[model samples]
Target: MASTHILSAYDEELKYLNRRISEMGGLAEQMCGDAVRALVNSDTALAQKIISDDVILDHAEREIQDKAIVTIAKRQPMAADLREIIGTLRIAADLERVGDLGKNTAKRVIAVQGTGVPRKLARGLEHLSELALVQLKDVLDVFASRSAEKAEIIRARDEEIDAMYTSLFRELLTYMMEDPRNITSCTHLLFCAKNIERIGDHATNIAETIYYIKTGAQLEGERPKDDTANTVGAPAE
Candidate 1:
């Protein structure tokens, strides 16, 4: 009877960890979407709200870490059980970073205020953010289902986000070169785009963690990356 009771309590602890992770994932998704909307619309009020709400993710991460540490110490989990706790810690950290990226993007809203973003650039940012958010949401679903196959699929899709970011980076550079007047706003947009790109990276990290938890193996080889922004040179004089 005591053994059964201990097992039940351990299961409950794991459930609580998962529940907290889901809440953090949902909040991070909302913050990322709102941050981009605020940037495109120059909505300082909404951006400020996102910045303030970031503390929630930070708090949740710390809570998860504390709980996981205590559970590990108490249960002395091994094998797959230990992997699950470790995976939760890794995912929580990635989600916290996602929230930080969203907060950073929201901070750009104040910088670009009163300087209108071009419709073309706005659309580009929106599309890029849409892809990143989709990746984040999909990986969170993969985490919940514990499907290694779906996690691998999400891992491969990171390259798509990188490609989109590279395209937008070029477009922003062109806008800056064409008109000196566009430099300020375009520069801020560049930072915002980078933040969105990083959000995708965090999503990929979570996908890898899920894959490890399910399979007990780190993904082999370098992660596929196509961000060519660093390779592009200045336009011919």
Candidate 2:
């Protein structure tokens, strides 16, 4: 009876971790979406909200870390149980970074406010963010489903986000070169685009973690990356 009670308690703890992770994932998704919308529309109020809400993700990450550590000390989990706990830690870190990226993009809204983003550039950013958000949402679903196959699919599709970012990077550069006045706004947009691109990278990292948790093996081969912005003399700013 004692053994059974201990097992039940462990299960409950794991479930709590899963629930917290899902909550974090949902908030990260919302922040990423809202950040982009705020940027395109120059909504300082919404941007400020995103910036403030990032603390929630930060707190959740620390909570998950504390809980995982305590659970490991108490439960002495092994094999699959250990993998699950470790995976939760990894995913939580990635999700926190995603929230940070969203906050960074939100911060750029103030810099570009009143400058008016070009309609074409706005559309490009929208498209890039849409792809990144879809990847993030799908990867979070993979975490819930524990579907390694689906995780693999999500991992492979990260190249698509990279390709889109490269295209947008080129377009932004062309706009800057065409007019000296466009440099400041376009530079801010460049950083925002980089942030969205990095969000996709984090999603891919979560997908890989899901795969590891399910399979107990690291993924084979280097992650496929197609982001060529650096080679094209992309600014570090």
Candidate 3:
């Protein structure tokens, strides 16, 4: 009877950990969406809100870490169960990073405020962010479902996000070169684009974590990445 009771308590703790991860994931996704919306609309208030909310993500990560450690010490989970706890830790870390990247993007909105970037460039960023946000949401779903197949599919699709970033990189460069006045705004947008791309990379990392938890094996053969642009120039005034 004692053994059965201990097993039930362990299961309950795992459930609590899963809920925490889901909460963090939801906040990160919302922050990413809000960051892009703030950028497109030049909504400084919204951007500030996103930045402030990053602290919540930070606290969530710390909470998950504390809980995971305690659960390990108390439950002494092994094999797949241990992997689940470890995977939750890894996912929380990635989600926190996603929050940071989104915060960075939101800050750029303030930096380039009143610069009035071209609509086409803003649309380009919106498109890129759209893809990244979808990837993040889907990968979180994969984690919750614990489907290695879905996780692998999301991992394979990260190259598309990278390709979008590369294209935006070129477009922003052209905008700056064509009009020196566009340099400041385009440069800010460039950094924001890179942040969104990085968020996609984090989503891919989460997918790999899910894959590992499910299969106890990392996806081999070089996780796909497509950004190859290497030009860095001073921010235009």
Candidate 4:
């Protein structure tokens, strides 16, 4: 009876960990959406909200980290149990970075405010953001369901986001060359685009974490990386 009782409590702890991760994922997704909306619409108010909400994500990450460590020390979980906890930690880290990148993009909106950037260029960013958000949402679903196959699909599609970023990079360069006055605003948009691209990369990272959690084995072969990003100023901005 005592052993059963301990098992039940451990299960409850795992459930709580899952709940925390879900909340964090939801917030990360919203932050990115708001950041992009701010960029395309020039909504500084929404951008401010995204920046403030990033603090909430940071706190949530620390909370999850604390809970994960406590679960490890008290439960001493092994095998799949241990993998789930570690995987939660890894996903939380990526989600926090997602929040940070989104917040940075929001800040860019303020940087380029009143510059009269081209609507076509802004729309390009909006389209790229849409693709990234879909990837993030899908990967979060994979994490929740522990679906390795779905995770693999998400990993394979990361190259699509990189391709979108490279195309935007070239377009932005052309715009800047057409008008020297476009340099400042285009540069800001370049950083913003790079930030969204990075969020896509984090989604891919989460997919890998999910795969490892479900399989207990590292993914084989080199991850299908898009070398086009190397020419995107490499999506590291």
The candidate scoring highest on lDDT is 2
Model 1 per-residue lDDT tens digits across residues 5-55: 999999999999999999999999999999999988999999999999999
* TM value for model 2: 0.96
| Candidate 2 positional error at 235, Å | 16
The digit string of per-residue lDDT tens for model 4 on 111-185 reads: 788885688987889899999999999998888889998999999998888889989988999999999989998
What clash count goes with each model?
0, 0, 0, 0
Q: List the residue pairs that clash in candidate 1.
A: none
Q: Candidate 3: where are CA atoms >4 Å away?
A: 231-237
Q: Backbone clash tally for model 4?
A: 0
Clashing pairs in 4: none
Error of 3 at 126 (Å): 1.0
lDDT score, candidate 1: 0.94
Clashes of 1: 0
Question: 1-237, model 2: which lDDT tens digit per residue?
Answer: 999999999999999999999999999999999999999999999999999999999999999999999999999999998999999999999999999999999999999997989999999999999999999999998999999999999999999999999999999999999999999989999999999999999999999999999999987888999968878885667
User: Candidate 3: what lDDT?
Assistant: 0.90
lDDT of 2 at 50: 100
Which stretches of model 1 miss by more than 4 angstroms? 234-237
Per-residue lDDT of 71-184 in model 3, one digit per residue for the tens?
999888889999999999999999999999989999998777888657888888889889999999999888879999999999999899889898899999998999898898
